[model samples]
Target: MQVKHGFIGFGNLAKAVYQGLKEEEEIEFAYFARSRKEADIPYYGRMEDLTAFADVIWLMVKPQDLSAVLEQLKTCDRAGKTIVSPAAGRNIAFIERYLGKEQLVVRIMPNLAMAYRKSVTAFATNQPENENATEIFGLLGKLGKAVQLEENGFDLFTAVFGSGPAFILSFIQIFKEKMQEFNLPGPLLDELLLELTQGTTLYFAQNQKKHSIEELIRNITSKGGTTQAGLDYFRTHEIGKHFEGILDAARKRSEEMSKNGD
Candidate 1:
């Protein structure tokens, strides 16, 4: 039997997940939009109508946009329907209060890397709700890694992994530009950087040899070597401390939003 799903917002993340699920023959999906024919998926003119066909409904709107959506949804009974939200700040209780006690709700935070099936997604839910738990896990399992975490941890995870990919990609691009500054050929630079980053990750995964990341760095930075010189430069420039502050600020903002973004 095909597992069908629907999305409330036809945004980039929604479209990406739709594409990923479409690749698998057993999952059928669609979305709701203002216009009926804007996207390839079947669109519903009204919010209540989407629940009719899909067992799972993904709420993919902005945090601020959620209130109006909820206002429309308030008139509908979502019993037996599983709703998954990817909004970074909203908690499951907030959703349940608005939707109803009988509704099955799960909150998730997924990064843009989900486009490539590399997302590290965190799901927070009342696990005692067996049906919703299974539905959420089964649906998200297709896109990438799904971790069940306490609600308190979701906000922090979003700051690190959900928003971390963009930060990492920006750093990668900065290095790529630095390679160009050295007059390296563009395609060769791209190829080298791609392999360089992937190889770094591969080293961790392939080596069953467990070592702390700091230990691994120390192992590479033997006394008076090139790695040591680079490490010294980074430390001297205070880049490591600056990054710690950056991540902390991001985490704080996520926490604040969760508290007030209703």
Candidate 2:
């Protein structure tokens, strides 16, 4: 059976989701937005019309705009439709407030890596045993590592997974900036950094099951080597603590948004 998936807001996240799932033979895509997007999918100007057509409806708007969209959604005939949301800070309970208790709402926290089918996603639902809800969770597993987690854990998951890609890239940016001393072209620097990250990831993937992360680091660190010297400076300056602070700050903001957005 071909499942019709409709997006309420066709922004970057919506685009990523569509791009990630577009190749599925059993899934079709469409969008309902204020203005038509550049995408070639079917477009509906009315929320009711889109809801009627879609078996799965993605609440793809930003958190601040989510209320307005849900207000409109509440008026639609949502029978048998699975509501999926990736909005940060908003929980399934928040969506159920407008849609009602019996509605199957799946709350997800995923990054733009969805476009590459490599997002580490979190999934929680109002209806756990519902077959349709389980199907949604299965689809998430196809996209990446999808874990069924409690709602309370979402804030930390958002900080670590939803916001993780950018943080990792920012760390890479530090390397790129330091490599300015090499006088190489900017694109070449990025290419070299990409190789470094990919090689590091491959190394981890190869030995991660049997070895601890600290052991992996120790394997690369020789006694008084360059990596150890850098590691010493990193520890002495408390860089790890500072990086952890970034995650904590993001989690705090997510918690704040969860409460105040109501």
Cα deviation in Å at residue 211, candidate 2?
0.9
Residue-pair clash count for candidate 2: 0
Model 1 TM-score, all chains together: 0.90
Off by over 4 Å in 2: none
Models 1 onward score TM values of 0.90, 0.98
lDDT for each candidate structure:
0.80, 0.94
Among these predicted structures, which one has the highest TM-score? 2
lDDT tens readout by residue for model 2, 24-99: 9999999999999899899999999999999999999999999899999999999889999999999988899999
Please give the lDDT score at residue 31 for candidate 2: 97
Cα displacement (Å) at residue 97, model 1 = 2.7
How would you encode candidate 1's per-residue C-alpha lDDT over 1-262 as one tens digit per residue? 7877888888878877876667878777877866564577788888778867787888888888887777777786577777888887888887877887667788888877677777788887755568657776766776788888888998679878988987888889998987776898889898998998998898776663788788777867889989999999999999998888778888898888888885
Give every collision pair in model 1: none
